[model samples]
Target: MHDLPARLPGAQRNLLLKHLPEPRMLCTMRSVKLLPGTAFFTGRRSFAAGVSKEAEPLKKLVYISQSNDVFTNLALEDWLYKQGDFKNSRALLLWRNSPCVVVGRHQNPWVEANADFCAEKRIPIARRNSGGGTVYHDLGNLNCTFFTSRDEYDRKANLEMIRTAVWDTYGLDLVVNKRDDIEWRGQKVSGTAAKLGRDVAYHHCTVLVHSDRSMLQKALRTGGVKGGYESKATISVPAKTACLREAEPSARVSDVMNAIGRVFLQNPIEDKHGNTVPSEAGGYQLLNPSDYWFPGLGSTRRDLASWDWVYGKTPNFSFSRTYSLPKAHNAGNNPQEHGIASVTVTLHVTNGMVTETEIKENDSFSQTGGSDLMHISALKGQRFTEHLLDAAVQRTVSAAMNAYPRGSSGNHRAFSPGPRLTQRSLIMESERNHDPMDREYVNSILTCA
Candidate 1:
């Protein structure tokens, strides 16, 4: 190490010695090579043209988010990726959110999350700009997003830093698997997803510190039957997950956050023969997610929290479900004689709106005016809601009964399907009706939350 510095001129050697006083510290400063006529070498590459054209040194940054709202953090990330400069700098953002479920860009929320359950639990669901599987987040989980220029983005290096942080801080050995997930004892402790833009790219991951496993399972696992969906959307691969606290009893969310922040700023160094070591440091800052802090961030947050981006962005898909029509919606057919009439509803949704709706009835239902009941073109452009499925039944059944008034056998009273309701009118009517359950159902499907 001393010899390397001696190779430089007197002024350069003196400056080098000033920064790195101890001999051992000089050895750790291997990134600072002795380039001729260069006072302090920083970048990994040699100067292409001359010393005057040498690029600026890479600046490592660790930013801790002040907001725990998922939408705010997501918007902050989006804003930084679109607006911030990372030409000669790398950033790592550490954040956590209140209980929420974040789905990937191309993933379906109905397939990725249990909507009715999440709605009842009041857990907001959001879709990020990145493409990957869905993940459940809460205060117990820690999120780390590594940002760099498109050419400088190194996902493996970021994962290595996280792996080294866990090993160094908690003495827990974690390995980066083929899927780029961090695993400990064959159980996932972290999940990775990334987005690569033309000029910028970011690799963000979730670190399960002491997250609620039960809630994670409930939030991620979709309930009800699953075979109806037919789409090219990305499906989440469920893995056996373990938390950092489970492996190291002493580990806490704050401790892991600080450890990752420290590791990120220090920028871990790898030695020959594949050994890890500590190296030089960088800057750290705490970022607050607000309009005052980040201008134009409010609009991005609103978009992320909007239904158009969250659910409307889902890939085109078809869903089929068999629903038993209510006795009143039997189209004047006697249920005791016809056995309960069930309709097979097949919906083709494109851009979150119903492009086509096909309802197939059984032989018992076909005995009545099933053809009239199948023509539900009125719901052509409406937003999807399994809860409002009964509306379709009523619409079709009213048409069937009105087509043949004397075909009725039941003593049921007169029924009305009322006016056709679009997505906006459905919510407004639900609110105006002041029915708590109806409003809750509408909110479950219509609201972004």
Candidate 2:
């Protein structure tokens, strides 16, 4: 045998020295040839091989699902980031939702929602966890979610990938509009949002190809004076919104979805650990709970649907404003009944501003009587503003407190300050409502701060 000194490198020799195991036993059954130089080199090779075997391999391809609701999709994406599930996998989520208006997580829903219009049409209003403006969606809309480990997540690159996928499948040159939307020609076709987490991030977009345009318009009211019920809310600019059918006249929702799937399948990349990763690869799945219908879907629909979550979460406060109006004769047969109207209004509020207001009729001898009372009541819970509060006070004077027809009266009286609650409070309540053993369920989902 060759001498070990002739083959073993100095670094390898030093490494062996550092990790040398304790000498335990020696056997002397047979006479063996002493190969002075070969033992060290052979031992070093064995050590190197052992270290390689001990290392863990990286995971690739993360399975994701298409959700049926926008809120559920947003919630699940938030859940994935908090769970650190994106540490080593890439996710593809498919999702859709009923006709509704969705506001960016940081946006004010009141401003984004057309309360009068939405209420008339019975469109649901929801807030997402991502940062963006308001968007409308229906069954015809398709939502896509892309999830990746925090270290590997790249918002710009991911967006490009999506743009490329659409272009490849439809042969349409879709441009990223306003940096947050995808547009065909000059009209917006998709609205995008993103949420970042400690170990992962998610980017989702609403594809309004074949969505119901009329319902979308009805669900999202575009024009309204800013303030009061509409204060600080996101407003959609008037635009001739079009569906994929209207735009292409030949494209369908399924056609776009299929095209997306094809693009992802055709393009694959290697993950951080050098493992080959596939896009839109099948194997993506979701963990179905005992109640699959609501699996991963929270009780938000029920809780938020309740007046408790909807209005009860508002902060506590009040608004006060004084107004003076010139006297005028009644248009009816009562000229002598005409008199100057003077009013001082006080409103109760909660949350960040006035969520509810209570108007105290300070002067009983005023000409408008309780006519102004109806208008003051409407001002409650509305954000405090010089202009809005003044207008509300004026409406009260015009109607003459009693002039507000019964039933025609705004439901301002129906609002009540029940309890002060937050997202945390709701989660706690949900846990108490379930079995103690399932507390983990609450813990797992309560990850969103």
- CA lDDT of each prediction against the hidden true structure: 0.70, 0.51
Tell me the lDDT of model 1 at 125.
Answer: 97
Per-candidate Cα RMSD to the true structure, in Å, reads: 11.0, 18.9
Alpha carbon deviation, residue 317, candidate 1 (Å): 0.8
List pairs with backbone clashes in candidate 1.
Answer: none
Q: In model 2, which runs have C-alpha deviations exceeding 4 angstroms?
A: 1-67, 223-240, 270-296, 300-337, 340-349, 352-449
lDDT of 1 by residue, 1-449 (tens): 44342445677666666654233112122223222222211111112112233443445657777789999999989977886666655678899999999999989888889787899899999999999999999999999998878876778888998898899998999999999999999999999999999999999999999999998888776442274888999988889999999988888888888888888877654433466543234444566666754678899899999999998998999887665432324334443332235557788988888899887764355444455554455677888765555566545443433333333433222222223334455545445544232443333333221
Error of 2 at 144 (Å): 1.2
Every model's TM-score = 0.72, 0.58
Against the true structure, whose TM-score is highest? 1
- What tens-digit string does per-residue lDDT give for candidate 2 at 1-449? 22233334667545534443332110111112211111110111211111122242222222234445545555555544554344433556666677878766544455557766777777777766666677887878877777776677666555566678777666778777657677778788877778777767788887887887877776665664334342343444555555666656777776776666555445566555766653333232332211232333365434534444433443343345444432322334343444333445555545434556555443344444554356566665555444455555434333342232323223223211112222344344444444232333323222332
- State, as a TM-score between 0 and 1, how close model 2 is to the true structure: 0.58
Query: Per-residue error at 318 for model 2, in Å?
Result: 9.8
What local lDDT score does residue 358 receive in model 2, on the 0 to 100 scale? 52
